[model samples]
Target chain A: MNKMAGSSMGEDTIGAIQEGIRNSAARMLESGEIDVFIGYEDGTLPLRTTPVFITCPEDAERLVWSPICENSLTCYLPKFQGTVGVVVKGCDVRTLVNLILENQVSRDKVKIVGVPCKGIIDRDRVGKALGTDRIIRSAKATRRSLMLEGDGFEVEMEIQDVLAPSCEVCRYPVPVLFDVLVGNESMARDGKDPEAGYLEVAQFAELEPDARFSFFAQEIERCIQCYACRQACPLCYCPECFVDRQSPKWISRWRGLSDKILFHLGRVLHVAGRCVDCGACRRACPVGIDLRLLTKNMEKAAKDLFDYESGLDIGGVPLLATYRREDPDDFIL
Target chain B: MLKMAKTDLDAFVDALVKASYVVLGPIQEGEATKFGVVGGEEIKIPRLTTRPLKELFFPQDESLLSFDRSGTPDASVDTSGVLASDGISPRVALGVRPCDARALVLLDNVFASDDYRDPYYTLRREKTVIITFACPLPGVACFCESTGGGPYDETGSDILFVEVAGSYLVKAVSEKGKGLLQEVFPPCILHEADDEDIQAAAEARARGELPANAGVPIEAAAAILGHVDAFGDSAWEEVYKKCLGCAVCTYLCPTCHCFDIGDEVTGASGERIRNWDSCMFPLFTLHASGHNPRPSRKERFRQRVMHKFNYFVENNDCMACVGCGRCVENCPVNLDIRQVLTTFARRELA
Candidate 1:
């Protein structure tokens, strides 16, 4: 398990990508092409990266590119007023596309510097692999393996074993749209079959209806109603969420099972067509809820029934907004 | 001081259970570990629970009172049941870390204050006994020492337990703890502690007391934040940029005690409830006329920092934060509070 892959993209590729990002960001800021550049910087802890906003050319040097850059920077688009330069992974570009299509952000105002993603690391997976009890003092990442060190212990594991679940089934390793692209796109993992993306959803669908209901019920019970999932989602930009509305309240603030279910299901429906499966909601959830189960099913239904995929065709009308004669009406009854 | 063998933990827990105490400890729950009622399973003390210890005293949501308006147009609400401070059973919270224990004391200033007392919180506080496990290993995110707390600090714990060799050197910090020790540790039950055991316990505590990270000048930060002009500091603009306006930091915070009370009605019957609230949320400061004083994430994030450092210190003579580091570990965007504190600590005041 400790053996590193010899053929994987090495540190040289990552360094080149980082350099390219810094050069692009500095040039853009210097030329007045963008007012601000959003990217990742080394976080305080190991295997983590914090979002950094660079408004000056000199500050652009702080930008780093690695598997640890897990946050989708597109979520900040709605909050900005001027032209914004954003570093995006493959999945983040999809979110950016949705934002543009929804008119939440103007396509002209964004300078998208897209990076071909190998895969982002899941901290929870790494924690579980190295025993959660062990405190990781430091970490060093190579091309294919990560070496974690703690007091009296050191462990090395291949990067593939700790990739986020969403990355494993990712069909878009290369950004679908970008104004400027960094790194050799060929170095990224090959795109998987579209059907492969729905494997987990298919397995979940096999469960009995009661089992599915109980699964969600059990998962939602752990939710503390912190709304981290909602806040992390780029699509959930409503001025007032339905749950928070005082007048004609949809879900009460009480921590009841039904109220919790209403909030989760309500969110799933709100982002049904627009969700790009960026894994932000899952990563943001503090309780480790399997939010993708419900979301992926919605994505699959949109694919099977409406033959529509979100954030792909920028000119196409949203799945829910545009109604066609061929659209499935069987659920209406 | 007393000592008990590590192998005798089950018997000790059994003894506590037999004594009519409801024991709660850290239990492994799927991928996450949280504080729950100790059943037959062994209690493995993790560095920290997924959720903080505040939930045991202040739940996420709880019913305050129930009312019925079906009988008359103008009905009198019965609030007597809400504040009834009787019949609360004794509870023992086991394996609490010093940071979390210190947080309870911070919360006590809010919930059990001189001006007003929340009976619901006071009753639980009065009935429960806290048993803290002196930390032997602090995590990467932990900076409890920087926030006026230490690995072996006994601020709110009734009893403090330190692991030494194959046994635990237990020290009673309160009268209730001493009484309980007398009841549980009969002459035949506990081992007589010696100098070697005490030395080992001290070494273990020293290991944990070693700073996990460089200490931030929290006192200096609090002083700077106390300045009225600090509210308009440009640092707030940069510090809050990456914040997603999520309540993960506040809700997971053991010291944050803000709550919202609302009435839920179904036709003629209704129930009043209190739920945890966060300054990170926009709705927390929304005015009736829709004129929010804290209109954006910037103001909200600033309020969170100021409240913990300046306002709380000014009012209660203590900082509200215990530096448990849950916010640092769980922030989706990696907005570290330590960095924010460090920024204010080194800021130049006008």
Candidate 2:
């Protein structure tokens, strides 16, 4: 078996946060404050981390914090009937907040342990950097760089060069909502400029309507209709998605371009204002479709049109669920 | 064994193309590597394609038949052109991994069974010649050795290509492969492999084999899972929690062959189609009477494991999984099947 090892820049800080999470989780589990603790554990492969659920106090020691801890544990929030103590990064906590706002998960039923995040390492970018065909045998990440090793090759890349696109423009490196905060909040990396987040969306919007349509058509054509994007998003918690409905079958099972487009467009509209730009959908896609082009556009529209952002306030109403007199009515005509 | 220089691979592909063979290999498709028609593009065989090779034979969605309401009902039904052999041509699938090649054999048990045969699958299987490339170094997620397969196991390959020093030692595993080799390389072009070449290939095979300790006790897990009481085991609750109910694992798995048949109707015409179905989907087991035996993700997840490890073994005398590690590597939640098997292996059967 190949030996796998990983180290991150600011190892000391990450270690402290992980330790803090373990201690708090153990304490909560033993005290019956929560039935399960959701966090991350070492994945089988390099440059990956899998969500881990700890039901026993002893298992809290398995909780880990790393740049690769990218999953939003809030996706599992609605499934738990009892109180859940879940570890959340900045982006993930927003998802938790969205779940609470939407009433999919009761705020009282979840104990959020928030860790200030730097950024997640994008595996796709790393793969591209080291030629897609090169099998990564082992990976080592330092504070600012990553060293990848294979059978006969080794490549080193700066940490900033391989961060998930969502992370690069993150506006919140520190969780806005948390019951227990791990590590000093002040130690978190400074958030990037808010407007800079939508630069890609703005550039995409500049394309002619035909060009945009064709681009999306080409992208959605590769979809195998796996619904990984919907399954990965915490906001997409409907009991039965429209695509899966039998009576009103919105989309057929055929691998046709129209049905594929309908599924993606429908999903984007469904999660229009609720998506937190967590990048889970893109990461979950096995085919690596650029799902953010549509999702991020909806996010930008939500912000620009309604001056609204999701997951910031638990008391806030969903964007589509409410209407105001001040809301733009020109589009209605 | 016949030796082919590393530099002559393109020419060999050209020879196959010249012989009217549609050559398919691992081609980079945007961000993912997939088995696609290789015209003149470089065929860089990754450890494994992001998508499985099964797609070439059994597509995700295929039309079974088409019918028109305007004509007489009996006469309107047409199945002649649906996946017909008129356009079907001889094809070569190159750079197939041993595990994926093994997966085809497992699929053959289902699609080309003694009791029933699927013409679509049988036709493709008969037309395509598979050339498997032996892995010299296994990836982190690979566990083919644990499931009665290995990096160099050439169970279903027509031809096996073992990378030796600066060249490939190609061995024909089937008569079709031998005939193809004779046509492509002939006697003058094909050089006999030397002892050094054979020794190097052996060493490479050994290097790629998974360490004995790395394997999960799959056989023991299979045995335990076969019992009826295993269905109600509490361990399933924990194992199924992390699954996001996504079809990534099943879609990418080479051995997963379950499919759903549906009819798409238009104003005056309709087409019957079959699509790949996943046990991970909530709708896969929904009965017409609104009764679903596997109602929740827990039961669905159990069915996936049970079908692959227990039921398949019972039916075919072999596990359905090929241990290609696609699920292990691509699962969003990192729900490792190896760990699931280990949990069952260590469980006390009820």
Each candidate's chain B TM-score? 0.95, 0.96
Top-DockQ structure, candidate number:
2
List ranges where model 1 is wrong by over 4 Å: A1-11, B72-87, B186-188
lDDT of 2 at A295: 88
- iRMS, model 2 (angstroms): 1.4
Q: What lDDT is obtained when candidate 1 is compared to the true structure? A: 0.86
What 10-residue stretch in candidate 1 chain A is worst by lDDT?
A1-10
Best by lDDT: 2
User: On residues A24-53, what C-alpha lDDT tens digit does candidate 2 reach at each position?
Assistant: 999999999998899887777788778888
Model 1: per-residue Cα lDDT over A1-333, one tens digit each? 111121233557777778889999999999999999999888888888888999999988788887878898899998799999999888888888888888899999999998988888898999989986898887767657788888799999898999998898888889888999998798688888868999889998999999989888889988888899999998888889988786777787786899999999999998998887889999999889989888888988898888877887767677888988877889876
i-RMSD of all predictions: 3.5, 1.4
Candidate 2: CAPRI quality band? medium
